[model samples]
Structures are given as C-alpha cells and as structure tokens.
Target chain A: MTTPEPDRLFTPPPLMTSPALTPPGLTPPPPTPPNGVPLPYQAAPPPTTGPSRAPVVALSALAAVFALVAGLFTALYLGERTDRDTIASTRADQERTLANVTGRQEQADATLETNRSRESTLTTQHDLLTQCVEAAKGYFALPPGQTPESSRLFRVMYDVCPQI
Target chain B: MTDHVLSIPSPPAPPRPRSRVAVVLLSLLVVLLLGASVLTIVLFVGAKEEHGLEVQRLDRTSRSLTDAEGRLAETEQTNDTVTDRIATLEAANAELHKCADPAKESIIAARSDDEEALRPAVRRAAENC
Candidate 1:
C-alpha cells in the first residue's frame, strides 16, 4: 500500500551486442581507452589485424612512373638505331656510285690516249705522202728524155708507204 | 600523451619516395647516350671529310677529262687537215704524171732527123762493099 521503490532507470543495450548494424559472427574487441580503463558508457573499438604499410604502396607507384620513363627512352633509342642503319646504307650506296663514276672516267682516259697515238701515226703518214708527191712532181719537170739525176724521187715514194 | 593524441588527427604526409638505384642507372644511361652521340658526331664529321675528299678527286678527274677532250679534238682536227693536204697533193701528182708522158708524135719527131740521114748513107756504103 505504500509507494514502491523508485522504478529502476531504463537500461540501454550494449553497442557490441546490437544486431541491427554489426555483421554476423564478428565480435567487437575490448576497448582500450587512453588511461587503459574500460568505460561503461562508450562503445568498444573495432579490431585491427596488423600494421599498415602505406609507404610501400607509395614506393610502388613511384617505381611504376620510373618504368614508364625508361620504356619511352628505350623506344627512342630503337628509333635512333634505325636512323643510323639507314644513313650507313645510304653512304655505302653513294660510295659505290662514286667508284663507278671513277671507273668510267679512267676508261675514257684510256680511249683518249689511244686516239692521240692514232692521230700521231696518221700525221706522220700524211707528211711522208706529201713529200712523195712533191718529189714526183720535181722528177716529172726534168728535161724531156733525160733520166732522173738522183734516186731522191724513188726514195721519197718508198718512204711514203714502206709496204707499197 | 596529450601532445601525441593531438598530433594524430593531422599527421604529416609521408615523405616522397626516392629510388637511388634508378637515379644512378638513369645517370649512367645519360652518360652512355652522350658518349654515343659524341661518337656518332665524330663519325659524321669523318664521313663529311671523306665526301669532301671524294669531291676534290672528282673535280680533278673532271679537269683531266676536259683537258683530254681538248687534246683529242685538236688531234682530230690535225688529222683531218693532214688528210686533206694529202688528197690535194695526190691529185697534183696525178696531173704531173699525165703531163710527163710525152705524145708518140713528139717522141718520133725528136728521133726522126737522125734516122733519116743514116738511111741514105747505109745504102751507098752497102753497094761499094
């Protein structure tokens, strides 16, 4: 009949045991407060398995950039190699053409020399023939019925064409 | 502890990573490329020098050929001149031969006087013997 003891305060459910948000089979780890004491009013900390390695990820990204640069350089080097090969072959071709031109020039020189010698021979023959004709003229002009005074005409004729 | 807890909310970003091996390799590659470029430059210079030398040789050859051609032309001209002279002389010689051969009447006339005087004497001498 008298007033009962003040009703006990309504108790709130613990955060770790709340099934409305937490995944199944996963339990929250014990809380580690700054003072190393568990507080009754706060939720527990989430579990952490091992140390993080963010530096290694950053280093891997840097390495990938370096590799990209090196690959570009290699491509440039290959292009240079092809250019060098093309230049070398062109130089060889030019040298071959020069050699051929020189050879032809030498042949032309030889032909020119032969022609000169032939011309000299013809000049000599012409001179001898002229002398023969002059001597024959002189012989014919002698007094009528007189024999030639000397063998000069005969000598000139024979010298004109030794075979003749 | 208070300072560390306060520092956790805004920690400095991690320092940029540097690859020492890659830097060294890049330096070496640059040096190698520079050396190769120098060598190529020297080769190009040498090739240019060779080209200049070949050009000089060709120029000399051209001059020589020109001179030879001139001489050949001169010789041909001389040969032609001589040939023409020879033909004219031969024609003159043929005319001289035509003139030198006397007519048969002239030859007979030259010897007929002596032969006529001897014919009457020979008959008079034979009758006495």
Candidate 2:
C-alpha cells in the first residue's frame, strides 16, 4: 500500500451531485456550467419569513404579566415586612417591659422578705421587752432584804433591759 | 476568448419589518424577565430575614412573658405568706398585751414595804406574766 500524498489525504471530497447520496433535508448543489463557474442567477431562498409576531408578542405579554405580578408581590412583601418589623419592634418593647417588670418584681420580693424579717425581729424584741418590763415590776415589788440580786426576775430584767 | 468575470452578490435584503418588531418584543421579554427575577430574589431574601427576626422576637417575648408570670406567682405566694405571718404576729401581740395588763396593775398596786403581800404578788407575776 503506497502512502497517499499529504495534500490528497487532507483534501475534502467534491460536493455530492447525486440527490440520492445527499443527506436528508439537504439539497444537492446546482450543476455548474462546463466553464466551472457557478450561475449567480439562482433564485434567492424565499425571504426567510421572520418568526411570526404572535409568539413573541404572547411571550412578551406573559413576561409583562410576570413582571407585574412580581412588582405587586414586591410591594406586598414590603408592606408585610414593614408590618412584621413593627410587630417585632413592639414585641421587643414588650420583652424589655417584661424584663423591667421582672426585675422590679424581684426587687419587691427581696424588699418584702427583708421587711418580713425585720418585722419578725421587731416582734420578737417587743415580746422580750414586755417580759423584761414585767420582770422589773416583780423585782421592784420584792422587799429589800428578800430581793436577791441573783433572783431569776432580777436576772431577766438585767439581761433584757440594762437601762432598768 | 471573452474574459470570465464573477458577478458580486447583491447585499442581503434589509431585515424584514416584522422581524424588527419581533426583535423589539424579545428584548422587552428579556427586560421583563430580568426585572421579575430581581424582584423575586429581593422578595425571597427580605421575607427570609423578616421571618427569622420575627421568630426571634416572638421567642424572646414569649420567654419574657413566662418569666413575668413566674415572678408574679412567686410574689403572690410571698404576699400571702407575709400577710398570714403578719396576722399571726398581730394575734400573738394582742395575747401578750392581755397577759401583761392585769399583771402590771397588780405589781403596781403592791407595796415594796409589805413583804408578805409583795412576795406573793411578785411570785404570781413572775410565774404567769
């Protein structure tokens, strides 16, 4: 097998003139004159009908509708967002108020507990004071010789009421 | 021999009027599509952010309310306890006064010099008052 010339190997085949050999949907090239010049008088392919306006118009209309709907939705969303933000802000304010109220409540509870403790202490002190008064009375009523300094009533008065 | 010359093809027919209209319509469609797309994206993003913030705020509010309720309940219980304690204290105070009054009078009436009477009175005051 002789190696073909490189130019011949790369050269494209002549256009197919046989209609049967042409690929489907492809028209065979028109025959050239013996002079090898193609005729320029060949009919121009019927002016390619520009795509019908109806489809593009309909598509444009649909797109316009989509754009309009989108615009409306955008407005609605904006309003919704504003309303939601307001609601969120209100809720935040409520949270702050609740926090303040809770803080106040805790303070009140602490104050109440302190007052209760103080009141209890005061009540206890009052009871002790009353006992001390009664003991002093008893001590003073005792006759001079019989009134021993070591007596329980004297001790009670001295412990609770040093002023006496 | 005559010279062979190739004739130049005429310029392609000007674009059809209908095709120009179609081009304009397609362009409009593109613009509308772009606008719709941008709007949709903005709406989606805004809604997402708002939803997240709203949810967080709602959660915080809910928690705050729960805390307030708990505090209120605690305060009420404390108030009731304090009120009951105060009532008890008052009653006890009244009882203390009841016991001390007559005893005080008796001690006051007794004479320091009267050893026999004073001794009994002092003993009764000490034991009961």
Candidate 3:
C-alpha cells in the first residue's frame, strides 16, 4: 500500500508568501512551493518580530554592569570629596596658626628693636660716664701746688663736663 | 473551507509574562545606569574643584608657616642680643655709681681745707658728680 499523503487541512500554512505576492518597498518572502507545501528538511526563516530574549537579557546584564561601575565611581568620588574637605579644614587651621605665629613674631621683633635702641643709648651714656669718672680721679691725684686751670686733666674734665 | 480555516493563522501567541517582566527590568536598569553615571560625573567634577582649591590653600599656608618660622627665629636671636647688651649696661652703670659717690665724699671733705687743696677737689667733683 502507498504511504498516505500529508492532509492539506492539517498542514500548517506557510508564514511567508511568494515574492510576486509581496508589495513594493516590503521585504520579499522566501521561495515556497506553489501547492503551499514545505519541503522536508528545509529550515524555517528567522522570525521578524523583535529581538530574542537572550540578547535582551545580555544587554540588561551589560546595563547592570555599567550601573555597578558608575556606582563604584560615585562612591570613590564622594570619598575623595570628603578627604578634600578634611584637607581644607586642616589648611584653614594651619593658616590661623600661622597668622598667630606671625603676629607674635612681629611683636617680638618690635620689642627687640626697642631694646636695641635703649641698649645703644645706655652704652653711650655708660662710656661718657666712665670717661668723666677717670678725669675726676686724675685731677684729684694731682699735687696741691699745681694750678688746676692750666692742667691737662682739668681741661679734659671741663670738656667732658661743661657744668664744671 | 479547511484551507480557509488553516490559512487564517491563530492569533499570535500572547506575549510571555516573563518576557514582559524582563523588558521592565531592563528599562529600570537603563534608568539606574543613567542616574548613576550622571551622579558620578557631578561628584567627580565637584571633587576635582575642591582638590584644586585645597591645594592652593595648603601651598599658601605652608609658605606662610615657613616665613613666620623664619621671622620668629630671627626675632628670638635679636632678643637674645638685646638682653645680653642690657645686662652689660646695667653692670657698667652700677660700677659708675660706686665710683662717683666715693669721689663726691672726698671732694666734700677737702672743701674745708686750704684753698690750694680745695680747688683741685672742687674741679674733680665737678667732673665726676
């Protein structure tokens, strides 16, 4: 007995039609048998619907990875910003300390300058006082018979002390 | 009739529930990615600007500290010198007073004597006192 042919009623219809049946500007359909029977072992055309789930899932995973990277970058930036704030605070403190130190140094410098001037005046007075004392000692040591007005010691005393 | 019935394909299988869920999840991930990227860029720029300002402030503070330290050192040195000079002047002044007072007494005692002796004592006292 001959093998029974596939029943046309039960055979599923081809999803695509022939190129002649397709409209212009539209993709032509793959070649199909005139009787609308699919050849055995022929591969089905790819679906025209949207992308499959695998590529979508992969793209979603990639997006998740990018988001994770961005989150990590944000965390790092925040930490660095905090560190910068800390540094800025420290710098401000250092500046205040430096200002105080500079003020103190300036005051000390002024004190030193005043002391130096006083010391110079004191030294000059000390030198003149010493010379006057020496002249007095020499004049008193001279003999009583010597005339005081013509003496070198008396002249020195007069010059150093005009009050005499 | 059978061909007509077969030709009319059954309505496309209803979209899978899981696929819809995946699309929603993908959209949420994209939004998350964009938000995170924008936040990262903003934070990065803010951090960079702060770093620049901090560096400038730190450099200025360091220089000021250095200058202040040097000035303080020089001031201290000058103060020491002045202190030493003051001590010397004080000692010399004490010695001068010591000698002047004694000589003044000697001149006073001589003033009661004869004119020849008294004249030299008067002149000496004038110079010393």
Candidate 4:
C-alpha cells in the first residue's frame, strides 16, 4: 500500500515549508519564524477570504446592549411616572368628591340636630298638652258645689291650655 | 496548454486551538443583557399592576360614594316625611284649641239642654251634673 496503483493519484495539499519540490541538498529550509510558528504564506500574505474582526464589533454589541437597556429603562420610567401622575390626579378627584360628601354630611348633621331639637320640643309640648288634659278632667270633676276660689282655679287651668 | 507536474506534500497540522475568552465574554454579556431585559419587562408589568390596583380602588370608592348618596337621599326623604307629619300635627293642635276654649263654654252652658253642637270629646268631658 506504500505505492499508489497505476490508475489514479490523489494529490494532497502541501504544508507551509515542505521540501518536496526542493532538491535534497539545495539548502536547509529557511529559518523558522521568530515566534516558532510558520508564516501563513510563502509569498505575498494570507488570503482575504475568511472572517476578519476588530474589537469594535464587541464594543458595538456592548453599545447596542446599553442602548436597549437604556431604552427599556426609559420606557419603564415614563410608564411608572405616568401611572404615578394618574394616581395623583385620581386622588385629587377623590379628595374633591369627598369634600362634597363631607359638606353633605355636615348638612345632614345639621338637619339631624334640628330634627332632634324639634322632636324634643314636640315632646315637651305633648307633655304640657297631657297636663292640660288632666287638669281639664279635674276641672270637670269639681263636685256640685265647689268653692268659688276652686271654680276660678279650675277655669284658669282648663282655659289657658288645651290638650286633645 | 503545458503539462506541469505537481508534487504533493503533507498538510500542516491544524493551527493550535485558540482561547475562547472573547466568545465566553460575549455570551456572558448577552446573558446579562437578557437578564436585564427580563427585569425591565417585570418593571413594566409592575406598573400595570399598580394602575390596576388604583382602578380597583377607585371603583370601590365609586361604589361606596353611590351607596352614601343613596343613603343621603333616603335620609332627606325621611326628613320630608317627618316635616309633613309635624305640619299635620300643628294643624290638629290648632283645631283642638277651638274645642277646648273655655270662654265659649259659658255661652254653651246658658243654652237650654245644650250640646247638640258640641264635639263628642267636649260633650263627654262637660260638667253638666
């Protein structure tokens, strides 16, 4: 298997400093590169066909990240600010509405007090009327010949106040 | 065309594998950015939640205010009814005064076998005996 068959040969690519094309005693291969790695090209420079990069791409990605984060933070900030403002506005509205309610409550309290006072006065009047009715009954209860002073007293009691 | 013979030599071993620190850094940074993005999304959602709670609170307050308004109207109606009752009582009190007036009693007494004109309550309480 060391030698190829006569039909076909598959040629392999060469290493960077290989000497297959060079004569055996022509000279030692050129000195190795100072870094011990071989030069990428024996003539001219590396092919311009593969990926090429600078740190700018990473920086650009980082800048894009910053922009995205900043945009998001700004959006959140504005949204929260708007919500807080709405809450403040709503609270003001509630306060105003509550003030009206408080005013109505005050009016209701006044009306209630007036009603209570009226009820108290009515109770007093009712008591007086009851006393008048009792006095009228007593006046009518005077016997067949009551004293003149008693008659005058009975008349005064029943005449001045009426209760029904 | 010329027939040029080509000699093949062994290919060099693949270049030594390089450090992947830059890829790792970019991956870690992307992960960090994704995390920040998630947190930003949460903050946005939290804002909506706060507003939602505000809306619910306002709705509750509105309901409470409606209830209070209804109660106030009921109280006002009650006041009107009581006021009307008081007015009726005042009118009744005025009418009772005419019956109970003692100055007219003398005229009624002088009349003969009198009291057909008197209300039942006055006749019942009259001292004819």
Candidate 5:
C-alpha cells in the first residue's frame, strides 16, 4: 500500500496566480487552454500569392505606349497652332501696311492729275497772252486827250483787232 | 449490328469571344489616334493656306510699292517743271515792274511846254499797274 517517494514529489505544477497585464478597458484574452484543454492557436501558412507577371507587364506597357502616343499628338497640335498664330499675325501687319500705302498712293495720283490739268490751263493762257502782246507791240498807242480824228482811228482799230 | 454513329461533333464551341474590355480599349486607342491625326491635319492645312495667301499679298504689296516709287519720281519731275515755270513768271513780273519808264520820260520832256498842264494825266498813264 506504500507509494514511491518520487511519485509523491511528482505533483502537478502550481497554476498562475497573477492577473493579466492587459490595458484598461480592453477585454483580456480568454484564459489560455483552461486546465488541460488542447490549444486552438496555430501559425498561419504563408499566403499563396498567384502568378501575375504577364498581365501586370501587359497593362503597364499599354499605359506607357498610350501616354507616349497621346503626348506626341498633343505636341504636334501645339506646334501647328503656334505656327498658324505667327503667320496670321504677320499677314495682318502686311494688310495694314498695304492699306496705308494704297491711301498714300491714291493721294499722290490725284495731286499729279491736278498738277497736269493746271499746267495745261497755264499753257493755253500763256498762248493767249502772247497773241495779245504781239498784236499791241508797236502800233498800240494812246492819242492826246482831245482829237476827234485820232479817236476815230483808235476806235476803228479796236473794233478790227482780233487779239485784245 | 451496333451502328457507330460518328456524328461530327459539333464544331468545338467557337473560341470564347475576346473580353469586352480588351476590344473596347483597342477601339478607343484607334479612334483617339485617328481623331488627333485629323485635328493635326486640319490645323496644318489651315496654316499652309494662310501662308500661301500671305505670300501672294506680300508679292502684290511689293509690286504696288514699286509703282508708288515710280509715281513719286514722276511727281518730282513735274515739280521741277513747275519750278521752271514759276521762275519764268517771276521774270515776266520783273519786266512789268521795270515798265518802259525811260522812254516815257523822253516823250514827256519833248513836250516841255505842255508838261505842267498834262502832268497829272501823263503821270497817271506812266504808272504801271
């Protein structure tokens, strides 16, 4: 009926008496494996990330190509727009200059025409003056204040003279 | 007799149609490229036309400028002619001013006895306008 001394000393280990050091207002973890209950905790296996290389590479390549093409189109569009603006500005200036020149040219032409007409008139007048001077050159004379016969001759000459 | 009815298996279901996303993306890219190209072309053509018109106008302006220069030169020549005519007129005016005064003086002196009596009338006649 007597038990071995080693069996008597092999008593179960003492249970933890200290309270868990959990923060205030937080629920403490359920008492781990109450007494001899089997543990439910286990390390999770490594996550199985599937193969994604091809699709990712394809999408990235597509995005890059699209961006490049779009950028090129934008650049071309900007260049053309700028070129048009510059050309239009230059043309506008030219048009304005042309308008001014046309006005000035018209004025000059009118002045020239007037000068020509005036000259023609002057030439005709000069010819008439010359005829009058020639007709009166030597014979033109005024008689003494009182002379009936001389007055008669002067009146006759005046009536007959073509250049007066 | 077991007849083996080897009916041609209906052609394997046509290969599944491509995903809508892939088709839509490709179509969008094509449409975008085409639209951009069209826009660029329109701009290019417009700019070219404006440039051509500008060139034509510039040429016309140059021709007009040349004509103006020639006209100006002709006007200068006309001005020279007018200046010569003016000089002629001035000479004529001077001659009128000199008036045959000495000849009139001789005639008056010869009529010395009547000089006093006819002085007013003769003086008036002798003075040129």
Candidate 6:
C-alpha cells in the first residue's frame, strides 16, 4: 500500500455568499400609487422608528393622567363650593325660620298677657255686679203690703247703699 | 481603483407623533372651567341679590311692626281713657238717680202738711167778736 502525501500549502475554497431573503411568510407587495400616480416605493415598518411607540404611549398616558387629575381636582373644588353655598343657604333659611318662630312666640305671649289682664278686669266687674244684685234683694225683703212710695224709697236706698 | 467598504442600511424614520387628543382635552378643560366659573359667579351674585331682598323685606316688616306697635299703644291709651270716662259717667248717673228719687218730693209734702200751724190763737178768739 502506498501512503498519499498531505496537500500542504493548499488554498481553501472561497466563502459562499447568499442573496438577502425576506422573512418567512413575508412578501414584497406591488407598489401602489399614493396620489393616483403609480410609484415604486417601499413602506417602512412601524417598529423601526426614532422613538418607540411605548415612549409615546407612555407620554400620552402621563398627559391623560395629568388631565384626569386636574379634572378631578376641579370637580372636587366645584362640588365643595356648591356644598358650601348650599350649607350657607340652608343656615340662612334656618335662621330666618327661627326668627319667625321666636317672633310668633313673642306675639302669642303678648296676646296671652293681654287676655289675662282683660279676664282679671272682667272678674272685678262681675264682683261689683253681684254686690248690686245683693242690694236689690235687700230692698225686695221689705215688709209685705208696704206702700209703693215706701217701697220706692227703699229701692232708692238699695241702689245707693251698694256704694257704701 | 478605490476599495469600497461594505455598508448596512439603517431603519427608516417613523411618522411624527401627533398631540391632537391632548390639545383637544386641554381645550375642553379650559372651556369647562370657564363655564363653571361663570356659573359660580352668577350664582354668587344671585345669592347676594336674594340676601339684599330679604334684608329689605325684613326692614319693611320691622317698620310695619313698629307702626303697629305705636297704633296698638295709642288704642290701649284711648281705651283706658274711655274706660275712665265711662266709670265717671256711671258714678254721676248713680248719684243723679239717688238724689232725684221721684217719691222724695211727695214724702216731704206729706210730712209738711201733717204739721198744722196755729196763728196766735186767732188773735184771742178775735177779741170776743
């Protein structure tokens, strides 16, 4: 058997170069007109951008949060103001009602006092009338068959005697 | 010949982001605040006006009450005076009734006529006639 000699100083084969391939399931679409004119243009994918959509979305979310916070604060402030006004109005109404009630109570008390005074005066007048009736009875108690003139004198005495 | 280096293509620029929604929301908030401020101001002004009217009404009522008080006092005074006058008239009437007894005159005449007067024994029986 003869031993084959090694290929010393042998040059390696050239590297194999491949053409760029689109991703699987992706295809280059036919160019379409943007303004009714046919043009050969490629649409840029959305992901490869200066700012990621996440940052813009975050900024938008922050702005929305700020707006919501401001709106909530404004709403609360307005609600508190409305409550203050309502409380103030209710307090004023209550005060007015109390004043009216107090005034009516005073009027009623005054009326009661006046009526009591009138009643006392009437009671005194009734006593005086009773005394007059008693005196008339005394005159009627005169002896029977007394002359009409004598009876008339006795009646005059009765009318005047009540004063003493 | 110049040697050319291999190059890599960079990604395309993304579309510029818009702030339309934020702008619209800010404008709406501004309008809402303006409307609320106007409403609050109008309500405050109306409340003040109502308070003023209430004060005016209370003042009018107080004045009327004062006038009524004065009238009531005057009436009470007048009533007292009338009561006093009535009492005096009643006393005078009672006195008149007492003194003007109709039978008083007849009683006095009866008493006087019952007492006969003798004139000096008729001048000693008229000097033996």
lDDT of 5 by residue, A10-112 (tens): 3332443224556667644433332333345444434434333454456556666666666666676677667667766766776676677667667766776
lDDT over C-alpha atoms for residue B96 of model 3: 78
Worst 10 residues of 5 chain B by lDDT: B1-10
- lDDT digits (tens) for residues B32-100 of candidate 6: 665665566566556556665666655565666656556566655655655665566556445443332
Clashing pairs in model 5, backbone N/Cα/C closer than 3 A: none
Q: Write the per-residue lDDT of candidate 2 for residues A95-121, one digit (tens) a residue.
A: 888878887788878878886886787
Work out the TM-score per prediction: 0.38, 0.54, 0.65, 0.47, 0.45, 0.36
Docking tier of model 4: it is incorrect
Best by DockQ: 3
Model 6: per-residue Cα lDDT over A74-156, one tens digit each = 56556656655665665666566556655765665566566556655654544444443333344334455677854764565
DockQ of all models, two decimals each: 0.04, 0.21, 0.37, 0.11, 0.07, 0.05
Which CAPRI level is candidate 3? acceptable
Q: Pick the candidate with the highest TM-score.
A: 3
Pitting candidate 1 against candidate 4, the one with the higher TM-score is: 4
Name the better of 2 and 4 by TM-score.
2
Q: How many residue pairs clash in model 2? A: 0
Q: List the residue pairs that clash in candidate 4.
A: none
lDDT of 4 by residue, A51-108 (tens): 3345437755875776598577769767886976787688668767876886787798
Expressed as tens digits, the lDDT of each residue in A32-61 for candidate 3 is 443454434434445646447775777688
The CAPRI classification for model 6 reads as incorrect
| Residues A103-135 of candidate 1: C-alpha lDDT, one tens digit per residue | 655665565566656556655645554454455
Per-residue lDDT over B28-62 for candidate 1, one digit per residue giving the tens place of the 0 to 100 score: 65655556555555555565565556556656655
Interface RMSD of each: 11.8, 7.8, 5.5, 8.5, 10.8, 13.2
Per-candidate Cα lDDT values, in order, are 0.49, 0.66, 0.69, 0.59, 0.52, 0.49
Scoring only the A-chain of each prediction against the true A-chain gives TM-scores of 0.50, 0.50, 0.60, 0.57, 0.48, 0.48
